[model samples]
Target: MSFSSLLASSQNHLTPDTNNSLTYTLSELSSLPSTSAQFDVDGAYRLLSTGGFDAGKFEEGIAEMDVGERTAQTQNLETFLEARHSAFINLSLKRSQELSAAMASNLTKASRASSWSAEKKRLQTSLLGSRTYQPPPSSPSHTLVVPSTPGLHASTWSANQSFPPLTPSTSTLSQTTLGATPANKVLWGASRTLDSHAHLHYRHTILNETSTPPDTCPGYLDLLSILETVSPNDLATTSLTWLAEQQRSIFQTFVSQKVTSSSTPITSTDFQEYTTSHNITSWHKVWLALRSSLIPQALTTISTITPPSPVLLTRLKTGSGKIGYGTGDIYRTLIGKLLDFENIQGDSPGISNTEDYIFARLHRLTRGGTVRAKKEDLEGLKEEVLSWGVKYFGNVWSFGLPLFCAGGFEEGISAIKESDEKGNVRAVSLAIVAGRRGLVSREFYEEVVVMYCRSIEGGSPRIAMEYLGEVGRERRKEHVKKLILSTRAYAELAGVVGDDGERVGNEGESTPIDLLFGQGEVRDILRECGDALGREGGGGTDAAELYAMAGEYGRVIEVVNKELAVRVDSFKNGVEDPQRNYWKIAAYNFAEKHLNQGRTHVIERLEREDNLKAGSTFQLLMNLTAFFDKFMEGKFGESWTVLDSLGLLPRTAGEVSNCVDNFFSLDKVARDCMGRVVVAGMECLFNLHASLKQDKSQAAGLTQQGSAGGQSLAQQANIDHDKAMRDIRDRGRLIVTFAGLLHGSLGGEVAKLIARMEAYMM
Candidate 1:
């Protein structure tokens, strides 16, 4: 609450009585609540002026208003304001601290010196203010009565309520004697010495959190006492909720234990009873039935012995919290995707009646629809355009257009349709909408589709692509293909729209053939965009992403392969690239990204079935990806085995010549990729060779120093070492052969590496 509001609350304290004299009325004001934190000066002064509490202070029967006495009342008002301000600041400090600082103190106080409680009490009183509690005069014997401050009795507490009792015989109250309460509950009391006012102190801290020096009543007695504070209905409801939560918690624990340990499965209890109590009968029985059916299958998993400390973690959430597990997004997104939403069908159900949901999806999609939005954020925004062709009409389209503009999809078809819909849309668009329901024929689509795209506010040809995309399957591919070629002519005329330097436009208007338009590509228009996204500074598979969109799957492999080659091309063979593991993931997994999967599969099938050249290239990419995956996992032995199987690392003299012949005959792109592969293969061989020699030397020394058994083991080791060394030398022959066969800088580099390996062999 604001300072003004706190002061304004004082108005509720008293009513003006014109008949009362100043002295008697002043005495009445003294009876007000001690919590003068809500005292309002204007309210009190107005009442005084109207004879609510005498017109002036210290006047008694004097007819004239005394200025000096009035000044004292003004000082008192300042004091009241100070008290409220100080109290508010102190409260703010404590509240902010309670969030984190209270957790800072270890479970218990470090020191238990006698002065600890006294000092804490002094600190609380100084910060919060001096509380003067007067024991009710009617309390039982031995309770001291502390006089209450004048004028602070309005409604702080009723006079009839009993004061917090204390053992006046002792100087300090034992924490153990206090009644049980929840961890969060608080009780306030002040201590005063009948000896003097100077010793008075207020305390706020409870017995160092969690460590309650025990001596409480029986557990049931404590619960009964606590329940006395709650009404019957509230108590019943709270108890039911607590019981349900406990059951759920136990069930979760059982599931966790069964999943991660050799714990026995929980018995088949009637869990539906608990759910039915709360009316959540939707899937409780089904879940129980499934559990019963699957128990035998789950037995192997549950009974399997495993290491401890493993847990099937709870669902991950953003921040220190997460949205409930069940409310996951129902619709998949399309923002940066290269394909349309197909009917594999897990689309989120959006009711046309839900204006807010529709608007929310639109608000994000059209704006985040820009070229530069983060892919993750864009993934969510893609769910928006799914609302398109769904009951969107009239003000909904027009109203959402500007928001779409702000989001940067200004030249989008929806924006164009919204602007055109008034005459062009309300009638023509609605006709198409009606036609979509079989109200119109194929002729209707051919008639307005072109004019419809042209008539939209911008007359953007790219809008034609979106409209054609809405056509039935037979026309969709052909219509979109022809339109993609048409966009090339308009590409030059279409200027960028947004802010200076930003891919500009407003009201969701972007330049001609923006990457955001239908399934996110415009072919000939994308040619420039694809080139622009190509790996700058020789990094990333972004170029490959666009190629996948434009049906240039081969080009996608080439682009991604270039990055992979650079990433795997070590300064020294077998030494992994300095780039992080994610670089490899992006390059190798490029085919699996959104919208590319189905298209990638199509290309894979075609390449394997008919396209020999592309098929070899795709197979090579798969080989390189597999080799590096093992290499990056620190599994050099497995990586070498992969390279060997692919014939990149030949073991025999005849195999070496065959590998070299195959390498030299490949296309330039394939050759460039192979050159890196061979280099990495050599480095890995050298790494293995060097490590083997070290282990053999250690075994030789151990054998010379040990018993006859050690001599026998050493003889076996020497035989294995000779055989492994011969295999290593055979693989190295490929590098040496390439050096003499190809007289280039690469051969010279290879020749130098072979000489270093020879020294290690010696």
Candidate 2:
């Protein structure tokens, strides 16, 4: 018999019989003999054919057929002609059969059910032909027969097989409903089911109306395209809808999998990945979404909010999500909405209740500054924040308040010099809190001093300093003393701090406030201030302490400048502070500790400058010459060697040489060299102009007395000299350019200028 006839005959057994003798149970079939005996038709044909032709190829074929048919239909409409409709159907069916068979095998292996029965049922239920295959008649002799050919008479068939009866009244599902089970649903098909994971479902619902099996259905790629097309209206709705659905699925899945619950909390990682994948546009949205979920305790998980976080919250308040979206666009629309909300809805006292509700649920403190509050509204915000702060962080500047305050302070201080009003206030508040709590660090004190120095009014720094001392009291006094000692230590340790090292003691040096309060003398002054504040009323409680701190301040200067006078009495000699040392010893200690021979330059320059009898020019020359000597030493390593090592010598050699030719050793050259080099340079141009005019009488021949030059031979020599002077001027300009380049290479303008001078002399 043909394979189709055998398959047809085999499935015929599914029909209920009145007599139990004619049917066979699966158990009875196991007892049947295995045979390679070829039926009239090939086994391959039986596997390929529809009917009991149940195969994996059928489902895949169904999907392929659906795609081809729909695609062809769309193509037909577009081309203004019908598709080769019959030919396309034929192709779809063929592909459907091929794919269904392949898919069936895989589904069967994955299901791991008894026999190939469940998969076969799923496949059969999915196929179009499985609905129609009918059984051939059985003989009265209790034999099963197979026909040899298609549509041939039953009389031509031979009865070959018989089976025991299937148990009566046992229910067998219809083909369609068999696949209706949730797990049996085809993915991205009209009907689908939950998979093993149970977290993600095969959602058969279509996102786009035009999508179908033959069509590429909506998926991640489709979502991405939708995102591209999102506008202020429809796209936002769609993106939000899609994201909501996705989040819902994730939530449900996670719950179903026991990954999260009231009893078993979700991890931060789960929340992070779930939120991150959704293409959320702003930090506010991220915050809202995550805040809606419970915070996970997992340390490895990191959740970040988008945007200016507070600004995002403001935008959310405005209800911009209803407006629209843009590709790679920020939530400006949302922000506008938030501004409107804050204007209308945020004002009423009733709004505080709503905000508080959210805060309580989210484990957030309902603080005023956490949201949008303009300068005028800050007081209200402050009231709200302080209430929340006391409730959540307590009245004292302890626990969460300190951490929160510190961050705000840092941000505020950073913005203060930039003239940010809000930032400055926040910084000031933070500093006060820090000082009050006695939690202030050296860095914080330094920052406070710097801020005071930058204030608009005079003595603001001193006032600020006194305020700190007053509030912090004895603790503040101790800190002030410690700060003086620290500053001394820093100056002593100055060699490592680069050019701004001196400013560590006197930071913001260019600002008048720093000049006033940041000097060593100010340390003594603060001691007095602190002692005065420490007093009970008239004289001071810490009067002796104050006097002692002031004396210690003087001692700091003494130690730093012990070498100043040659006389023995000038030394701190038997001065009370145990920390005091003689000038030579201090210098030796500084030099030895910093591990550099060059520190002596600073000492020598200070002493020579301090000695007024040496004269101002002499002092300036001494300082300049000291700088020159240090530059020649090149503590950072030779500039030429560094450039050569970097292979930049090739590109920079000419510029380097030009700078060298301009700056050094012009004195031996007196007139010629000065005229050719020094006079031509930028710094010497004024001097050059003055030198070129030996006679005042010739000034009239030129355009302006100073503006014109002489043309006579001696005048010409002077003219020639003037020309050389111009060359020197150009050289100076060149030196400036070279200095800039050297700065980039050697690290600073001063170093570069010195290096260029050295190279010029070389």
Candidate 3:
């Protein structure tokens, strides 16, 4: 028989009896469980087929026929039997007549019912009423096995043919495994055809019923420990892979709109139970589900990570010095996350309600609204402002400066050292904040001290002074004290020095300070000092002596006044005390006298001769130049040559000629210096001019004083007015001419002289 025919014939043994006996009859024994059964039956039929009896011939021929048939059928029958048995056993199928026809022509019907009696009895005696059985009690089904194993055949029968298993608990599973097995299970049952939906439900129900609580699930900690053992680089690689998966899953969720509404808390008890017991926390599950392929559900979640505050936004907007990434940067980052949370939660119900509340509070605070309405005051507001300021400042300076600088972004950062912030820009400082979020540069502290000093010395010197004094009292902060003191001195000087020269007294007008609308304190201070200086016989050092030494007339007056009031003894000499003041004042005075006398003598000689002084002008010019030159040469003589020898003075060999052109003009020096003191002089001249312009009656007192010396009207006018005008014009002419000669000389030779002269004045 052919394999198909034999397979069909083998199923003949299956027959449903009354009361579900599930037996088989030989007459219609369409199928068999083994090749032996078919062989035995075929042998019996062959034997019975002999009709006529013959002695030797019949016996020999019969034996020969039997041998030939048995040999021929041996291999074929074995192959056919194996096919039939495997089909019946593996498929649990019934055979058909058409299959028998297709197999072989040797089939014959059995007449006796005793043919399948043994098989029927065996089936009846079995514990199960039917051949099909539930899982575990029966041989396991293996229909889903890859490449089709024997176990799978049994499993399929057991699983499909029997009742489902009892529902199992999933609570004991570890969090880490919650999503693992289910995914495999889904893949397994996807192509099922027999009551596919119900089959799936049944399989799931059995697994669920059999599963232990997540907490009892094993391998969760092992996986985490394995993860921990990974190198950071490997971990990062893993994380990247995991993150990609998460993004995909989130995207899937978004597309499916499953996680969109999210009213069912992500933190549900079921989730907690599964995650904890299975070790399948959100991150793990997310990673597991999406690492291979990106899905919409995961992408949505990935996009949602952000910070919460504008303060945070401000910090992270760029890599400026103002903000950075340490504690403060971290805080800002958290705050930014919070802000993002707020935006996401916009009008949604049951969010934490923090970011919006904080935002509102900040808004009110900026608008001058009191935080604690009833208890608020200036101090409270100040405290709040300071709190925020400190947070911002600390964030920007503490962590930002270094990080931004390290990252090649130093635009906003200031010096991170304890030094000046003179050239610092806002962005650079902000970048510093970004780079080193939580640590301040040493410079930041120094800058604070500097600012404090400026505040003290700016609008209110006394306040500044008091503050500095307080700093001084704290002896440990000597540097701070010195800084403040220095700043105070600078502020005081700046305030006093401004426009003080506007007021003049020589022309009979009040001092400019008097004309000023304000500056009461400054005026009072000056007056006190002046009064003290003028007091007769009262001084530690005379004003003249101090002036001669330092040439700081205002300071001299102030010190003299204080000394007089305090009864300090004055220095015995009228001139400066050489040792105490470094002898610079004496040197300066001597230099000035020589310089003035040289100029006056040269000019007088020229005028008297009714001719130019030839190279005398050059000589006089050299005298002015030589003043500083000679002093420097003598004082710093060991370092440099003398002025005349160095060719810096009038070194012309002839009386008239070459070197004359080389002398610097005095006119330019006078013009430039005029910018500094001309106003003072003009104020005096203006008063004089005003007096001259007034009616003769108004000027009668001054006129009478002039006449008291027996001066005629013409003589009075000529000696006083005319002579004064002449002197003014002469000085003016000399200065203007000098300016004309040296206005734009790029060699800066005149500039060097101007600088030297300016230094000498101070």
Candidate 4:
């Protein structure tokens, strides 16, 4: 018979009988089992193929045929059934073992043990052949299964062979029960529940475990270590939410600790290395935390982690993130810290030491040959350095000279105002230093001139002037000239002149112009002025004044003669020079000063010069000077004669008004000189008034004689007295009106002259 037919016969016999008992008793089978010779195993095999084995039918047939007598065949059949049962059990055990091993390799040890228990329960259920048998509940481990293969049937069973059922131990039952239960029950179970809700407790337990534990619920250090191993993306995927929570908590704790213990030394080497190795995108969080805890240390750490200049510049070009966070944020933060002079308190090493360190680091990071930092960053850095240097180093030039030089001249000059006198001097010195190095622009020198000239009116003009002199010594002549001219122009524009016709408050001190350019250069400048004005056909009176101030009589005379010749030439050409009157006044001042020394040549030359217009204001000034010189020399008569010739002896109100109007028509500078001329003319009028009064008194005394000849003399005296009284009244009114005009045209000095002339008239 074929194995399929035999297996089919065996299957058919496996069914339970109708009476619920064996149809044939073992006694019947025993009747034939005594002798192997009587057993027909081969014939039984043939019969096994013809009809399926019904235990009742087969037993009855065996009894009728005395088949029970063949004990050897029965024994052989029992051996076959036992062998088949053992083979089936072995196959099931092997499959279960394979599944368990596969699961053990793939899952955690706890899961693998649970899977083994589930597999054992499944094997027991299959072996028992009981309808009440139940499979274990599916779990993480139970989800695993053995891959099915052909011809491997789990239900294949033998009736004659029996295996013992599995009875689980108490501990194993509890474990299986726990695995079978719902997740909520398992978590809440008293025996299986966690000891504490704190993460630290759980973390400690995880750290203490010998097996490879999960990194899901790790501590701070554990997370840091994991960061070293995993990529930023993987790390984020694994513990992003947990890391964010931990980051906030840890940062808060760090800040609290730092705030409580301000002297604690904070370091970021580990954090930096971890973030850098993982290329963490949320590094700004870490940096911000560290900075909040300890800014200087955090900045120092970040500065080290900054990429090379090229890479940093490229990243910066990519633009900052929404919150202005980027790879270059560290550099910017460091720069801000370094520049925050007002807030940064120094260590025991002092602010300078800290500044040096910061500056060195900045230079090292930003130095990209010619390019350095980004344009905006470079400009911001320059401004910060200038501000910081000026605040801490006494001046920007002292510590940030290169940066200041790189800036605009207006910026440099504006920086000067932020400093004291000493600081300004130092700044200018540094500017000169830069100039010597050929790093300064033309605007720098120009700005310097402007600054120093501005200071001339300020309270620190002396120091400013001294510094300007030093600068002028090193600078070009044109620059010095600009300085001098700017000082002069500013003084003029600001109306810095006092009542004395000199710069206000500088009488006792050297003028800024004189101090900046020494007297020798001043004389040269005066000569240049003379030449320049002469070329322009304007008088060199300003030059003559400067020369006279230097006590250079020769140069003063030279300038006056050149100026007089120019005026005379202008008159001959009918150019109608307005400044001719001013030049003549300047000449008059010079001549009067030297007149007592018998140096009256200029006065004589001015008077004899006819091209200087016979009735012009120039001739009036010369005549006035001659009149004053004679009056001071006790030549009152000649003074009177000179004054009369110049139409100063006004006989009526019309003449007096005309004279006063003409005097005021001159330039203000010429008006100042003409004030003295008016005073001299008033003196001549006063003397005439006094002489008339004396003659009138004497004529009254003579009229009292009453003799014929005496009467005739008295009559002539009376007529002469009447004429003198009219002249005196007219002259006194002229002097007083002229004095009033002088007071109105000129300032207090002329008013004083008016008072003195009024005293003589009275």
- Ordered by TM-score, highest first, the candidates read 1, 4, 2, 3
Candidate closer to the true structure by TM-score (higher is better), 2 or 3: 2
Task: Give candidates' CA RMSD values in order.
Answer: 36.6, 33.9, 37.1, 39.7
> CA lDDT of 19 in candidate 3?
31
- Candidate 4 has what TM-score? 0.27
Candidate 4 local lDDT, 1-762, one digit each (tens): 222232233332332222322111111233242541233332233223222123333334444542233332233222322333333333334334224455335545565455444433322222000111111112232121222232111111111122111222112212322232112121211121221122223323533423444222211122122222222212211222222222223323223333322221222433343345546433343233332222222323333344231222122211121123334554344333322211222221111222222232232322222343434443554455454444444333333322331233235544654555433433443343334323356557546644644654344333344344434354534444444343434342112333222333244554555544555665565445444544656536555554444344455555555445434323324344566656666666544554444525433434444334322444454555456556766565688777677665466777877877766665333455555565666666667667767767777677676665565443674457567546655665676677676556655576677566566655
The 10-residue segment with the lowest total lDDT in model 2: 125-134
lDDT of 1 by residue, 118-203 (tens): 33232111100011232212112122222334321211211222211111211221122222212101111111222111101110
**Against the hidden reference, what TM-scores do the models get?**
0.31, 0.19, 0.17, 0.27
Cα displacement (Å) at residue 147, model 1: 95
Q: Which one is best on lDDT?
A: 4
Q: Which candidate achieves the best TM-score against the true structure?
A: 1
- Candidate 2's displacement at residue 107, Å, is 43
* Candidate 4 RMSD to the real structure: 39.7
What's the lDDT for candidate 3?
Answer: 0.29
Give the per-residue lDDT of model 3 (tens digit) for 1-762.
422233244443333232322111221233444343333322322221111111222233444442122211322222332333233322211212223333233222231123233222221121110121111111121111111212111122223343221111111111121222212222111111112233234423533533532121111111121122222222222223322222222222222333223222221222223334555434333222223221211222222222122222223211222333244333233333322222212122211122222222222222212445412432332233233321332333322211221121222233322223322222322222222222234354334434444543434343333222222223313432243234323222223221222222334443322222134433433434334445644433433332322223443323422332221111234332333233333333433543345554323433544533323332333333333333323332321223224332222234123322443333332223322222222223333333343433445555576645564454455546545544434433333334334454423444344343333322
By the TM-score metric, which is better: model 3 or model 4?
4
lDDT on C-alpha atoms for all candidate structures: 0.37, 0.29, 0.29, 0.38
